[model samples]
Target chain A: MSSANSDTPTRILESTLALLEAPGGKLPTMSDIAKAAGVSRQAVYLHYPSRTDVLIAATRYQDQMLDMDTALAPSRTAANGRERLDAFVTAWCNHVPKIHGVARAIMALTSTDAEAKAAWDIRMTDLREGCAAAVAALARDGTLPDSMDQAKATDLLWALLSIRNWENLTQTCGWEQSRYAMTIRAMAVATLTQDTGPLTDALACPEPPA
Target chain B: MSSANSDTPTRILESTLALLEAPGGKLPTMSDIAKAAGVSRQAVYLHYPSRTDVLIAATRYQDQMLDMDTALAPSRTAANGRERLDAFVTAWCNHVPKIHGVARAIMALTSTDAEAKAAWDIRMTDLREGCAAAVAALARDGTLPDSMDQAKATDLLWALLSIRNWENLTQTCGWEQSRYAMTIRAMAVATLTQDTGPLTDALACPEPPA
Candidate 1:
C-alpha cells in the first residue's frame, strides 16, 4: 500500500479488483481499503458509501471499457473488410481478462436496475452498429462473398464478442488470454468471409483428452 | 407470496435470484426467501442450509441439462454434416434459454469450489469431445472444407453458446427466444458452410449515435 498511493481512487479500484477475486482471501473492508490507500474510510466514502457502492463502482470500473465507442476507431474503416472485422474482434477479446466476473453482475443488473440497463444499452447499440459496419465494409469490397446478410453478420460479430464464452474458455478450459484472442480474430475473419480454416477445425484436439 | 406455490424450492430459488440482484441482498435469510416463496423458513432450510448450498442447488438445476451427453450422440456420426452440426447447435441454444441466469452463476464459481468446478469441468470436457466427433463426422461428409481446424471449430461453437450475449438479445434488445434460437442455428450452419445469403449485409444499417 505504501509503495503506490499516488491515486487514491485507482488504489481503491485495484484493491477492489483484488477483493472481488479474493485470490488471497475475502474482500477488504472500507476501513481496510482506506488504510491501504492511506486515506480514511470517510475519504473512501467521498468516492463510495457502502460495500454495494464499492461493488458497483468496481462494476462501473470494469464496464467503462465496454462503453468506449471509440476503441480501435482507426480500423473501423480499414481497406480490407475482413481486417476491420478482425480488428474489432481482437480489440473486444483483449478486454476479457479485465471484465471477467463483471459480465455476470451485468446480467443480474439487466433484470434488476434501470441505470444498469441504460449503460448496457448504450454499449450494445454501439457494438451492433460497429459490427454491422465492419462486416458490411467487407461485403462491399467483395472480401466476403457478396451474398451474405449484413444484419445477421453483425449478430455473428456480437456472438464473437461474448464475454460469457470467453470466461468459459479461460475458466473452464484454462486457455490463456493469447489463445482466446487468437481464436476470436480467427473466427471473426472466417465468419465474415470465406475462411473455413477457423470454422471447421479450430476446436478439435489431436491429442487424447486428459 | 401467493402467486405461485407449486414447489417450495423453486419458489425459494426465484426469490433468491431476485434477492441476489438487489442491493445489500446477502445470501438471503431463510425467512426472507420463505416469505417471498410463501413458505416457512424451515421449509427453505430443508432444501438448503447455507447460501453456498442454495447456489449449488441453483447451479445444479441449470447444469443438469449440460451434464447430459445424450443430444450430442447423434452428431458423432451423422451422414449429413450440416444436419449434424445443426442438431448440436439446436440442442445447445434450446438448453440455454431455460436455464437463463443459472449458467451465469455456474460460470462465476471458481476452480477451488470442488463441486462447482467438477461439474463445470465435466460439462466442458464432454462438450469438447462432442464437438470433436461432430467436426470429424462433418469432415467425412464433405460438408466442411478439408483444412478446417477441429479445436478452433469447437471454440466457434462455444462462442455461439455465450450466455451473457444471449441474455443481451432477450433482455436488452427485446428479441424473442425463437428469433435468437434461429440466430444460433443460422450462425452455426452459415459459418460452418460459409453460406452468406442475407447475413453478409451485416453492415447495411448506419451507426446509431453513441
Candidate 2:
C-alpha cells in the first residue's frame, strides 16, 4: 500500500480503537472520531461512512497484528514439534498485549452482535488450527511418540492457552511476558512428553530433560 | 446473622447479580431489581446503597463458589501429592462456567471503575497465594520434587488457570466442561512430575502418547 493510504487507515484505526477502548463507544459519533483523529468530518466518511465500517476495518487491523498464525510461524524452527508449539505459545504471550481491549470486547459484545463474535471467532479458530497443525507436524515428523492422539493434544493445547490464565499471570502475578512465555512453552513441552505420573507435581518440578 | 439483616443482603445480592447478567442488566435501575425480586427499594439500599456496592458483594459471592482451592479440594484424594493436584484441576474446570461472566467482567470493565478492579485484584491475589500453598504442600510432603519453588510454581499455576483460556476452550472450542476439566487435571498432574518427557511431547506434538 502507498504510504499516504497506509497512514490513512492506520490513523483511522488508531482513533477508532481508542474510542472503543473508552467507556461506551456505542454512543460516540463519527464527528467525535474525526475530531479525535484530527481529520476532516468529510474525510472520515470518505473511508468509512458509518461507525460499523470504521470498527470493521479497525478489527481487521487488530487481527493482522495479534493473529496467532503469524506469531507461531517464526518460532516453528525449534527442533521438535513440541518446541515449535512452545514457540507458538511464546508468540501469543508476545502478541496479546498489542491488541488492547480486543479480546474483552469480543467476549462481551459478541453476545448481542454476531458480527463482533464472527471477527473474534475467525481469529481464534485460525489460532487453534495453527496450534493443532503445529502439534501434528511434530507427530508426523516422528518428533513425538506415536501413541498420543492429535485431538487430545489439540484440546490440551487450547486448555493451556486459557484467557483467564494468561491475563491473570501477567496482570495479577506480575511476571515479565518473557517469563510468562517461558512458563507455557515449558508446560507444553512437559504435557506432550511426560509419561504417566503425578501430573501437577511433575509440572511444578524443576525443569529437567526427559 | 439475623434473618431481617443478612437475609436481605442475600436477596439484594442475588437480585443484583441476576439484573447484571441479562439483556436487561446493562443499565438497570434499583427500581427494576426491586420489582424483579418483589423487594422494597429500601431493602437494596439497606444492604447496598448503590449499584457499585451490590456489584462488589455479588462478585465476591461468585468467587467463593468457584474459588479453585475449595472446588478442587474434594477431588484431591489421599493420592500422591501430584495426583491430588491433578484432581484439583479437574474439579476446577467443573467450577468455572458457573462464574464465567463475572470473570469476563473483571478483565474488561467498560469504565475505569477502581473499586471493582481493587476488589477483583484482592480475590486474584488470594487465588495466587492459595496455589502457591498447594504447590508448597506437595513439596513438603515429598510428593513433588524438592526443587519446586513456591513463587514460580504459583506463577505457572496462574498461567494454567487463565480465564480467557477457559472461555476460549469451553465457549470457542466446544468442549464439555467435564472433558475440559479432565484434560487439565491430567495435564496438571503431569506438568511438574518426574515423567515429564511424555507431557512435554503432549504439549508439542499433535499426536497421542506412546
Candidate 3:
C-alpha cells in the first residue's frame, strides 16, 4: 500500500482517540470521525466497514500507541508469582489514569450501544486474562489460600482492581493515585493470598529483578 | 392538597422509574415523562420546577417505594460491630440487583447530565453514611486494625460494596447473587478489619438477634 493509504488508518484512529479524550466528550459518529481525520467519508467506509470495526480498531491502536506490551513487561517477566502480582498491579494502576478518558467513554456508551459494548468487552477480556495469569501463578506457587477457590480468587482480584473502584477512590474520595495503587495491592494480598505477612509489608516497593 | 394534585407527582415519579428501567433506556426528557404520566407537559412543569428537580424527586420516590429504611433496619439494629458490618453487606447487596436498572441509568446519565449526577450523588452520600457507621462500630469494639485508618476503612468498604463491583462479580464473573453477597462481606472483613477468621466463616449466615 502507498504511504498515504497506510497513514489513512492511523489518522482515523488518532482522531477517534482525540474525540474520546476530549473534555465532556460523547461518542463520535462516523461522519464526525471522517471529518476529524480530514479524509473523505468514503475513505473511512473503505477502510473500516462499520463503526464497531472502527471502535475496536481505535482501541487496539491506542493500546499500541501506549506501548502496552513494554508497560506490562515487568509483570509478564517477573521471576516469582508474588513479584508478578505486584508488578501487574504497578503496571495496571499506572496505566488506568492515562487511558481513563477513553476507557470511561467506552464504558459509558456500553449501555445503549452494542458496538461500544463489544469494543469494551474485547478490551476487558484481555485484562481478565492478565488477572487470571496472576491468580494462576499464585495457585501454582501455593500462595493462594487453601480457603479460597482459585476461580473465586481471580474474580475477586479482577473486581477489586476495576477502574470503577479506582475512580471512586481517587476521584470521589480524593485519594492520591500512588496511595490508591499501594492500597489496592495490599488489599489484594490480604484478601486473596495465604501469605501471613503484615498487610503494610505488602505495600513495600517492589525491587526490579536483576 | 387535593387527591388529583398529590397523585400528579406520584404519576410523574412512577413514569420516571418505568422509563429509566426500560431496556436500552435513556433518561426521559420532560415531555417524554409527561406523556408517560398521561399529564399535560404543563402539569410536569408545575410539579417539578426543572428536570433535575424531577430526577432528584424520582430517586427519592424510588427509595420510598422500595422502603430503603426498612431494608436497612437490620444493619441499623445489629447487636454488635461485626454483626452490623455483616448486616450492611447483606442489605446493600440484596438491594443492588433490585434497583440496578435505574441505578445504571442514573450513572450512565451522570456524564452529560448534571442533574443526573446530583441525583446519583445524593443516593451515594447515603451509602457512604452507612459505610462510616459500620467502620465506626468496628472502631468502637477495637476490631479495626491499627493499620486501617477509620476514614480510609470507610472509603474502602464503600468502594468494595459499590454497585459496579457487584455487577462485575455477578454479571461478568457469573457468580450467584448469594455467593456475591457472601463473598463481599468476607472480603470486606478481611481487608478492613483486624479479624483473622477464615473468609468462609464470615459467610456463615448471620443470625438475627432474637
Each prediction's Cα lDDT score? 0.62, 0.62, 0.81
Q: Among all windows of ten consecutive residues in candidate 1 chain B, which has the lowest summed lDDT?
A: B201-210
Error of 3 at B26 (Å): 6.2
Query: Between 1 and 2, whose TM-score is larger?
Result: 2
lDDT of 1 by residue, B1-210 (tens): 233745777767767666554544344555776787777878877988765567667565545635545755665446577778877766766767655555445545532355665666665666567566666667677666444455555655665666666776666555566666766676666555544344444223222221
> Looking at model 2, how many pairs of residues clash?
54
Instruction: Put down candidate 1 lDDT per residue, A78-177, tens digits, no spaces.
Output: 6687677767777777766666555444544544455665665665676678778887788788766443466656765776676667766766566677
Looking only at chain B, model 2 earns a TM-score of 0.71
List of chain A TM-scores, every candidate: 0.67, 0.70, 0.82
> Which lDDT value does model 2 have at A199?
39
Q: Write the per-residue lDDT of candidate 2 for residues B1-210, one digit (tens) a residue.
A: 112344667867666666666642354567876765568888778878676667777788766645665565664453566655665555556666766665555544433466766876776676566566567666766655444566666666656665656766666566666656655555555554444345544333222221
TM-score of chain B of each: 0.63, 0.71, 0.83
Instruction: In angstroms, give how far residue A68 of model 2 lies from its true place.
Output: 7.4
Arrange candidates by TM-score, descending.
3, 2, 1
Q: Which stretches of candidate 2 lie over 4 Å from their true place?
A: A1-10, A16-33, A40-56, A62-80, A100-113, A142-148, A162-164, A193-210, B1-9, B17-32, B39-47, B61-80, B83-91, B101-112, B142-148, B195-210
